[model samples]
Target: MIRALALTLTLAPAGMAGAFELGFPVDCTLGETCFIQNYFDHDTGPGMQDFTCGPLTYDGHDGTDIRLPTTAWMEAGVAIHPVAPGRVKGLRDGMPDIAKDDPAAPALNGRDCGNGVVIDHGGGWETQYCHMKFGTVTVKAGDQVGRKTVLGKIGLSGNTVFPHLHLAVRKNGVEVDPFTPDAPTTCSAAPDPTTDLWEDPIPYDSFGFLDAGITDAAPDYAAVKAGLPPRLEFAPDTPALVIWAFFFGAKAGDVLTLRLKGPEETVVDQAVTIDRTQAQAMQFTGRKLRGSWPLGDYVGTLILTRDGVALEQRTLSATVK
Candidate 1:
């Protein structure tokens, strides 16, 4: 069951986070690409539900949020485009894209969507692009746009944390899930939508593995977000080594396993089972060693599985002097 309320948390996937890996609405760069920060909330009432009854969504969230990993990318400028051909119907721009903790963010009022663009595809198909960077919108209120037309750059405008494009789709003005185009979420009794816009929407077993790294210490967001990450190399005098892996979704009874192998064939293995369904990441810190250590290459491998089936696996490596 969804909690009575959604307390503000870090970024999250709104839906199942699936894709055909083709024809993205934004210029997708490796490590700089966007993930589904939120999927549309299919539960239009008291209980919460995504199309699959998954935890990847919140109550009332009505769009597929493609989110950037950091604010730096927002400033660097990422392009936003339309998935299908359409013409501009409405738009707004110029609101500052600030952090959720910023004091000036709350003043946006109904303009919280910040700089945005709207395109109306023919035949009951209309799309809304929200959180565009200021001064970057290339189209006007009544301009025509192609499937690949550059609408604007992604930004932190609107009610958002990281940089992203909240692509809200509608049919005749009522909200709809872009992922499941054929089946209306309101008809919960129907099967999952078979029609999809993506050419290949199947996600890999470990698709949720967003980022992984080895650190000199138990990592924090600041350290993880550091421009020069703590992985790849470490000094000989380093006190302790910590390994972390970030993933998207997990439910009770799912198992997460981690293993570390040293140059001399030393191995460290640890495992944890999720206690509930939620969006989160996990960390594992190796024992702090004092003596000068014999180190060359160290590897950390993570696998997430349930019911004897592997859902995902990831590996990280670091070197010491």
Candidate 2:
């Protein structure tokens, strides 16, 4: 279960003097090619909370983390763009895109922001883009840039275990949540976006599918995170057929349904109610072969429901050859 904050609070004073609007910072399509992995931590004390008063953030986390579903996506390149026009104040490059936990990773030594760039948007406002890939920084320290400028590609660098762009917005020198620039003093309700800094409102998203696939047996979690290509076909004599899903933002009591069907018969159908809140989760269902699977196409579907509302569904296909 998610740990809840105990203190009661109220909204902070409205508005920042001369605050400006910002645009989406990535080149990929939202929800399809990239997802918001974390948001600015709004909790003033020890516990963490996002602008929506959710557990999508870590304690003292001061940025919104935009992530790709796989390292392969990162390797293929996902461009990082500025959220607004600004003058490049400073930049870093040439940091290899390696997970911090990898045996070959370099020491952090305070370079946790990894290969990053900082831009000054005037009026004491600035933005920082972090965890960028090596040799991808395109602008010099003093370049004037527009929102369309490609600063770099997101990467698994710095203090990060995954590939993402940790974007931090600031004013003067203090960190600010672009989603709630007014600095609401309470987590009582979702912030009113009328006062937010986004030129277009970015919806507050908490849950969805990250990856799904089919295989002949149980899949490894590490391999899923590494974005291994899924097995598209199985042999007739394979031991079992497995359907698995990788997702994020699971809440207690949420229901997950996994169903598999062959051209001639339904193989496995199961629904599971989650018992605890999880930032990320995985589930699978499979059945051992009864001699051999019928030679045909197979489809696997995953559905996530919260409060009886079907929130997401995804499907993968395979064939017996």
Candidate 3:
């Protein structure tokens, strides 16, 4: 059973002069069945068992299993919306989901970060929504969103034991406990010189930020259509490589294909079918491709299409040595 936070705490004063008021990512009603897992202290330690990924065993109690009521809604399309106004900063798409039994899976992984979006609310403060349904993200990098803007739907796409929004507020680029009383005080008292900034986003409900309203706009198909073919740029490193890709003109329910080719045109192909209803990123490791390649030159191409019609394509080259 998930523990619920008591509803009687005073809202933390918005930190940093110019810090934006953040919103809740879901339409959580008072007394509704919504709970935050791993809100603070996510890393493993005493009393902190990993809940994101599984092999979950806690004193003979399987931890991954959520103790649900006899009638629980485990349906897959809960909408994930922006909690505050911000600009889209980063996104990833075309990554594969980690296997349920993969022992190496983190409580969160690139794929479990399925179709994610990062929104920067200024002052170096950002919010990230992960494990979203494929292709449902309604915002893109560089686009601006208001408090009620729908971002995507919640799903178990990435490294998640259950469907829930993974949210955090960063100060100087590091995740800090928003609920900590001394967070704002500490951040306000002594500012970090290296980054020279501080941020604190009060978790929804913990304060009095409640569901105000929902914006019902037609799905942004133009933005969706613009993300069709995924584009990749690769830079080689001595033993490892850096690969980045941009996907555009894509929609929910579209199937995307990715291929990495080496000399002689040897191809390693992988495919990801997107749930266009959501706006998110798809990213993954080329572990299979890496296993087969010798340290040398390579090229990657990503193709997007639906119902046999070619949508878009992008290609890039890299060196592995």
Candidate 4:
């Protein structure tokens, strides 16, 4: 059986007005085709083999890829501005462009997420803008930026088949469907531009007024608990056993330590650094084990800490045959 555990942590006030907003990185022009690609959409079709459309892998495609055609012959170096005010968390430059056929390359010079910037919008939310032109990153990691601030210029770099920006939002370190559709899925050959389009910046509507009213609400513990789907149910008649555990609500800079204990507290002491400023959801599965120990109680604990302060912790128990 597989279960989902989510723990949310908010580092801002209970309610801060307009803490975060979504805006188009570039002005919508005739040739500029800006659309949001659903995480699921990226999974189906010919997009499967391309890892850029899949879930975040060890290779570092951390956020969703926002594709837009270039309106003009954009210079190799241009400036990308911040859609909203936030602190710059990560930046990389001096890389080269990636080949059109290879999606695995880094963002710069055959790299993925080429010369990019990640901005922390506070309140456990973050946004990543990838595929900037090389040497255009004007801000360094950890710099504070305001709305409309130029961070870099658009470019054809990284795992990009064309000139486009990959943008994504993470809440409490977990990526959600920012482009939630108002209607159900309609199977078709051509991509539906209406429902398929990325939702306009949540911060400003067409009129430039705050839409969602930037919020710094405390961690929604209840929502986090409710968001997690029920654990996978298993039967004793099952032939082979395979179990997975998915966890959400971890932020970058947090130290994640996992321990599996059966009779006593035996620690595995695996340490991982959450580099993505956005919330992260990870699934850990137990590979096939030929033999099974005596059916008993087992405990799995996930501890998250940052700067010596314990942020979140979760424990789960299971019985084996």
TM-scores vs. true structure, each candidate: 0.81, 0.90, 0.42, 0.42
Name the runs in model 1 displaced over 4 angstroms: 1-23, 29-32, 101-104, 186-193, 197-207, 222-230, 265-267
Clash counts for the predictions, in order: 9, 1, 34, 30
**Best model per lDDT:** 2
The 10-residue segment with the lowest total lDDT in model 1: 1-10
The global C-alpha lDDT for each of the candidates, from Candidate 1 onward, is 0.66, 0.83, 0.45, 0.46
Q: Which candidate model has the greater lDDT, 1 or 3? A: 1
Residue runs of model 4 more than 4 Å from their true location after superposition: 1-19, 28-64, 68-72, 76-78, 100-111, 181-321
Worst lDDT run of 10 residues, candidate 3, spans 206-215
Please identify which of the two predictions, 1 or 4, would achieve the higher TM-score against the true structure: 1
Candidate 3: TM-score?
Answer: 0.42
Model 4 misses residue 100 by how many Å?
Answer: 4.4
List the candidates ranked by lDDT, beginning with the highest: 2, 1, 4, 3
Which model, 2 or 3, shows the larger lDDT? 2
Cα lDDT tens digits for candidate 2, 171-229: 77667777777763345365777877888868776787888898878888888887869
Model 2 spans > 4 angstroms off: 1-14
- Which residue pairs in model 2 clash with each other? 12-185
- The candidate 2 region of ten consecutive residues with least summed lDDT is 1-10
Comparing 3 and 4 on lDDT, the stronger one: 4
